[model samples]
Target: MKIELIYPRWKKLEGQTTFHLPPHGPVVMAAALPPGVELDFLDENVDPRDALAACEGCDLVCISMMLTSQVKRGWALADQLRARGLRVLFGGIASMLHAEETLAHADALFLGEVEGRLGAVLEDLAHGRLQKVYNFMQAHPPIELVGPARRSILRDELYHHKGVRMVDLFHASRGCRFKCYPCAVAYLGGRSFRPRPMARVAEELAAIPNGRLFVVDNSLAQDKEWEKELFRTMIPFKKTWCSHTIEDDDEVLALAAQAGAWYVYQAVFDTSDFIRQRVKRYHDHGIAVEGTVLLGLDDQTEDSIRRLIDFLLEIDLDLAEFTVLTPFPHTKCRDDLRKQKRILSDDWDRYTAGEVVFQPKHMSPARLQELYHLAWETFYRDEPQSMKMMKLLQRAVARERALGTYRGRRRDLVRQSFGRELTDEERGV
Candidate 1:
């Protein structure tokens, strides 16, 4: 059987950074497929050829739709694939929550983890007895069996920035302990935390073949004992990594730093004293902290919004990412806004965190949107204060790249002086 595992383009608003990381969901699905299937994996964001041409002669077209920004594109691609008499299946977080809408485009919809469900789907395909919907959210496959993501199919060069391939997305766990109103993790992965076995996780990390990684777990600090053990086990691998954090204990923070922790996305919900202390603790442990601030919350006003940005600088956070409260489908925030009839737009394009699509309790939607843009503009403006913080890192990165190039050239020149033919590695090509 020939299958085209596709990742549709996610729309990004102007001024927003288009993150072109390895789409872990689709590649992981490709990894989970049963044997005897030929997979042509195309992340359309980077591999842009006509979608129809890309999937030509493929028996099944499977698209993983996780972001609202890309749901529309996934649907269009699904429609086209179905028009060509190809079987189209839609799955992932976005499709899981909006299954009814997704069914309109796909011949089948796969809800929940692909671990146990994919085999049955493939069997159905082989026998020509595929069902319209496959439900496997209830079946929790043990973490060890989740399988490694198939990365050989990736075009790695297309995902680099400033000579760094950024980070490889790897999941050591599923779900989160906290059910934040605006987040969809709980909805998709459930409230209870499920972690991959420590040995299994270490093996996956070793297989990645990259020093920089982004562990896509909800919060690595949640289970203290397991995290300590995981960190201790990771010492031999010596890979630098980062993950998101909740308020963590001193011991866990210490363990994380020892285990190659580089930075963490610590949410700054407010300018509270504890938030300041938390940032300091991370810095004290030699782990940089990135502030993930959610703007336009019910408590935020224009004054408060500006004050938050000022507070970020005052705390000397390594970096910051600002986002408006996006009401994704099936999340608590979306449900509440729907009850109040405050959702202003059904358009998925506006769902990017930069745009305001729902009514807020304290301010006009327009005001909230304005403040969102202002938060970014003010943080990244050409002022010495802002530039000093951000540009310092840019300059440091530039220096590292130049130094690496110099060392490579120096080595090549020495080899040439020996009158030896250049090996592929020595050519510095």
Candidate 2:
């Protein structure tokens, strides 16, 4: 029997970055399917046409989705596949928490981690005993049970969009240890870090093309020693990479820089002495750090927002992304917002981090929305600072493209270059 795994596109939001890469959830789910099962993976974000066309012959279709903005698109895809007379199964962070709503459109719903329950689900389907719901209670499954994702299905041509050559896509671990109130990782993976073996991770990285790699892990610093070791191994490859980091550890930061990490996506939730120290480490390492700020946290007052902006400017971060805090389903913040009657919008489509979902403690919902727009306008709107960022990014793009050509890498010369500073004028920052 043939099985198709589909990932839906997110709703378009102004000023927000649209990810044209494959979704990791469906890739991991494809990895876990029973051996010999005729499985195909489709990420509509990158391969929409092939995905829609592949829906024809599949015996069963599974959709992995998020709760925020992808709800409508996900359901629409499910509805389409069902119209083709294929049994539809839905799962992911969003579907896990909102099973009843998802079940309205899908024939079966799997909750929690897909790796643990995938085999049984496939067997049940083969024997004509499919159930409406399957839940995996364990938070972390054994590594042996987690099979390698079938990423080979992704073609080299898919990476060559507009000009960006795609490189390796990897997940070093599962679960986040932080209890950040608004983050879904804390709720879904629990407050514990479960990492894959460093040796296996290194092997995987070595197997991928020797270019810029993107680590989709929650945060590289979650396991300091493991991250350090990984960086040490990566240094030899001299391949630029990007990953999320909470704060800068002096040793790790240095190692990451030497290992060819061009950019670090750091989360600056609040400004403090600790944050200052971390930012200094990035500056000292000559690494371009992109500071991502959450503007609509409960504690963010008008003064605090202005202060945060000033801090970001003071640090001269290469790039920054300011988003309103969203309380996704299954997160503590969502529950709290529901109880406090702070959620101003029930429309799941607007739940993407770009939208203001709840009224802030210090500001009304409308004021919060205005503040969100103001933050972007103040930072990225044809200002000198924004212009500087754009020039930096343009230079970096040219440099990376040159390097790609010299190296004779078949990868498209997309903006995969690191250290290019983007200005507000160029990016409309």
All-Cα superposition RMSD per candidate: 6.5, 4.8
Where is model 2 poorest over a 10-residue stretch in terms of lDDT?
A: 413-422
TM-score for candidate 2: 0.86
Residues 42-160, candidate 1, lDDT per residue (tens digit)?
77776756778988898888988778888888998888788888899898888887788899998889988887568788888879998889887756676678767878767665565
Error of 2 at 276 (Å): 2.7
Question: Tens digit of lDDT per residue, candidate 2, span 56-116?
Answer: 8878888888655777788888887778778899988888666678888888998778766
Residue 307 in candidate 2, Cα distance off native in Å: 2.9
Best model number under TM-score: 1
At residue 34, candidate 1 shows an lDDT of 82
The local distance difference test score of model 1 is: 0.77
